[model samples]
Target chain A: MLQSIIPLAVDALANAALIFFVAVGLTLVFSVLRILNVAHGSFYSIGAYVAASVGLWIVGAGLPDWLTFPALLLSAAFVAALFGPIVEKTLVSWTYGKSEAVQVLVTFGLFLILEDLQRIVFGIQSVYQDTPMTMLGISEIGGIVYLNYQLLLIGLAGVVLVALRLFITRSRTGRLLAAVVADREVSEALGIDTQRMFMIAFTLGVFLAAIGGAMATPTTGVAPGLGADTMVLAFAVAAIGGLGQVEGAAIASIIVATAKVLAIYFAPSLDAVAPYLVMLAVLLVKPYGLFGSGSTRKI
Target chain B: MAHRTSIKTLLAATALVTSASVAVAQDKPASLDVGVFTFMSGPAAAYGMPGRQGAEVVIDMINAAGGIDGVPISATFVDEGQGAEGVISEYRRLAEEPETDFMIAALSSGNCLALAPIADQMEMPTVGWNCDSHQLFADAEHPYFFRPNGNTIAEFMAYVIYFLDNNPDVERVAIINPDYSFGHDAAEIVKASLAAFKPEVEIVAELFPKLGSSTYQTEVSRLSAARPDVIFSNLWGGDLENFVRQAAPRGLFRQSQAVFALGESSMNNVDMPEGVIVGVLGDGWWRSPDAAELGAPEFAEAYQTKFEKAPVFPAMKMANAFMVMKAGYEKAIEANGGAWPTDEQLTAAMEGMTIDTLTGSMTFRADNDGIVDQVVGMVGSVEGIEGPVLTNMVRYDGDAVLPPEGEDPMAWIASLTPDFIAAMPKPGSYE
Candidate 1:
């Protein structure tokens, strides 16, 4: 059991790293914007497409191989920079203070449009740019050969978790965002430039989602329908963690990934439904989530 | 007294039916409008687009040759990436069109199963180009629906025989297939075949990932940790490419005798290490010796010129489907005194017919299932070719592996003995 559990745990953490990037960003957006961005996964895939294209171009142009690492970050920033303001100012802003049904319907429509746009831009064939993944090579853990890149994702997720916490608690803009999350009406009353706050928070969410996609490109193929798959999993993780709870999202990602990895390992038939089953059990026991509160919401 | 129709009324009904049959046998459209259904988008498109291109090029060639009885063939491509409901709707829409004469119904086995009953109901002539699931015709029969590309039973059973022969010392095996009927059915066939041939072997792990899953790291870890002597998967299109890309770097291929059932399609698109076992499901290899003698090399070169990549098995399967369609049309035309053949006549032409293809010949049995050779091999680099191609190929005669007509396929597999495998052709024996 110990031998088996060690590998399962490593697999779970590796899986969780990818899921956490999108789930945390989703919960973060819901925390401040009070809107569930259904199209959030589109940003993730767009970032992936941009990263794959840029990485391929860099390699093709005979640039240094190490540059692919920074290119991943730059690709995420590029996606957020290009799409963040345009989509928020136009489509997502309309859903502000609206009913959840309206928000979902509108964002679902946006999701479809963006999915088509990706096809038009990237075409239907899958794109692969694994310079970053192949560069790091492989490592043995728990008697299993693993990609060092997979371990890097785990470490990056941890760094992002700590850095995000620090940003929210210590940074001025993060404090303003936190204040808004605590009491939106009061923050607006205190002349917080609520409109600017919405843009900044939304853009940051996009950045997180995009980076998640960008980092994933070295391991996975960037293709159509990726956004929809990622979005569904992210939604499950956020719900299992309790919506709008960042740390809750983080823990829930691990739980969900573990459920999936365990299913793949033993109950192979249940791989697809494992995350949902975990969500069902977690929600049944705690209406809020592992780290979420019933009465209070936190950023 | 039983409530029965009057003699006059019965005579009238019989006459009307006779007239309808006669009209179907005699009438032929000036042109054949075929509905070619395959994937044109999404992950499956990696396989589907090649098939679609094959259909296009083959039809263009036929048209350039003045078509059957001077009727140029035209095609309307319906994307099978849409679910079965949409595929059925598209098939029905095309069938309803007076100009549409026949259909190369689908690349997906799921869609093929759904459309089979509808074809029989509508009396439409349909051919399944790449429908590979053994379950398609296990319990169901369709007169107007036929598959020229063969089924999963022959395909996966061949792999089991080939693997057991090459690696007699293998103890444990693992399978990670896509989560679909195609994947699950292959697993069942492989396991059943193994149990009959080598009862001592143990299956250590089995996983069915969701189709089009973008990542396989966890599955890879589980497979590696299982420490199986053999690892087998039937994942195709982008999903297969993705798995090979991720798994190769971790030395999973080096650790186990990795077998990709549909690896031929991605040989050009991705870089696979030498010595991995790959197959094209059917004997549709684009570079086989038989293919070179049969002019398949020229077609492949032409395909590369047009599509920027060499033709894969899916392309060959699609090209073979077109050949079968043309042969059926010509046979029907000849039988009907050089006139156009209706759906019934076309279906009659397809029944119990044997047609030669680019790779090999196929014989359609009474049940509308075709018997074609199954090719399996290890990947190796040729001196002049730019990429890896199949080496150490063994072509198993189709009839030897397929369950006899009307027999329960699984039960027939269970009844086989080790002597049965010993008597069959061994690897590299065909060459």
Candidate 2:
């Protein structure tokens, strides 16, 4: 019984670690910007493509193997630095004061454009770079061999969660961003730079999503249509955890990933629809989500 | 007056003779327009692009050899990545064009099933270059569409037979197929074959991951926990590559005997470990003895020179489909006394036809289904070879594994027994 349960727990946590990044980013953007970023998943896939390409080039150039690890982080940083501000300033800012429907429409259109742009830049074939995974080697857990990179992801996710909490509670910029999320007009009246906070919040969200994609490159194949697949799952996670809640997103990632892993292990046929089923169940019970409140503003 | 009457009679007879000759012969066109369908984008393109390249190379070769009866072949490619509705729309759009003579359509089995009846409805002669679903011709017959490679029944069964022959003590089996008709049908066939040959063998786990999935780590863990003696999968294209890449690091292959039904396609792209069971769905291995003897090397060489890579089984299958199509057209033209044949004439000529392909000889059954050998082998490194090559190969007779016509394939497989398995050839017999 212990043996079986150990494998199940490890699988669920490893699966959750990847989803948490994108989900947290989606929730963060929603909390600050007050608009659902439907194109958030595109950032993740772009980061993955960039990381795979850079990693391949590094290895192809006979660079040191340890550099591939830093390349992953640097690639995510590059994608975030490049796409985050430009997208937030241009098409995203245009829909700032519009209706929710307008914001969603604009972002969905952005998703389509970004998806096509990725195909043009990355081509149609899948890109794989496993140097980081191979260099770390393997470990036997619960009597089954698993890549140490997978375990590292679980730890990294925890680190990100703690770091994000500290940043939000202790940092000056984070407090201002939270102040804006609390009441944009009140924060603006208090001499807070609300527009700058929105930009900072959006860029940080892109970093989170991009880092998630970059970390996944070692274990997954980065290919066309990956943005769509990741986007759907991230939406489910956000919905289940309560949109705009970072802690909720983290917990929801585990719930959603566990549902998916359980379905794969037991029913097998329900693997594709398991995450959606969880979302449906959660929403049916808590209309505002697990952590969301209809009357109170919280981030 | 008698001289005038004689001249009029002579002119009338001349008109009658000219009309009879026109009725018996058709004016040959300047070129043959063929609509080729395969995936050109997305993950499946990893498998589909090779097929498209194969079509290009084969068409170039055919056109260079003074063309088919001196008429060049002009091809327009349709990307199957755009879902079935778009594929159907494109097929209709191309079929309505008067100049379109033939179609070598479809890489996905789902697309093939969707387009088969449409081919008959439009009266277009189409060849299924890589679709191998048994369900395509299970219930209804489509005269217009022909598949010159054996279906999932023979393809999956050949793997089971070969693996069982090598590992006679194998008991527990786990399956990880893609969640589609092709994958599910292959799983069913694999299970049926196992039940027939080894009754005590238990299915420890069965996982059907969705097509185009980027990761298989969870499924890999599930497979590992099952601890089966053998793990079987029919995942192809990038899905196969991803699975092999992820699972190899997790020591899954080291623990279990892995059987990849469409494995040869990724052998060039991925570093598949030695001793893993692999096969070309049919006998499309370019390095196989039969394929080597039939000019597959030359075709592969041209393919490498042009595409900058070796030809996988999908490419070889596409080339073979063109060979069969060429044979069909030539036979129809011969039967028509050197005139271009109509669509019905082409289909009729292909019925029960036997022709040589770049891989091996394929015979079209009465129902326009094909009979080709199944080559199963293990991935092994040969001296001076860059990547993995098939070793310890067995070429199963196509007819020996195929179910008889008008019989339910599953029931036929269930009827098989260990005695029947004993009568079949062993692994490494064809080498």
Give the alpha carbon lDDT tens digit for every residue of A12-126 in model 2. Answer: 9999999999999999999999889999999999999999999999999999989999999999999989988898999988999999999999999999899899989999888
Which residue pairs in candidate 1 have backbone atoms (N, alpha carbon, C) closer than 3 angstroms, thus clashing? none
Displacement of the residue A60 alpha carbon in candidate 2, Å: 1.1
Q: What is the per-residue lDDT of model 1 for residues B75-193, given as tens digits with 9 covering 90 to 100?
A: 99998887788999989988998888889988999999999999999888999999978887889889999999768999998898888888889899999999999999989988998
**lDDT per residue, candidate 2, B183-238, as tens digits?**
88888999998888898999999999999998899999999989999999999988
Query: What do the candidate models score in CA lDDT, each in turn?
Result: 0.90, 0.92
Q: TM-scores of all models?
A: 0.96, 0.96
Model 1, residue A204: what's the lDDT?
Answer: 91
Fnat per predicted structure, each in turn: 0.86, 0.83
Q: Cα deviation in Å at residue B371, candidate 1?
A: 0.6
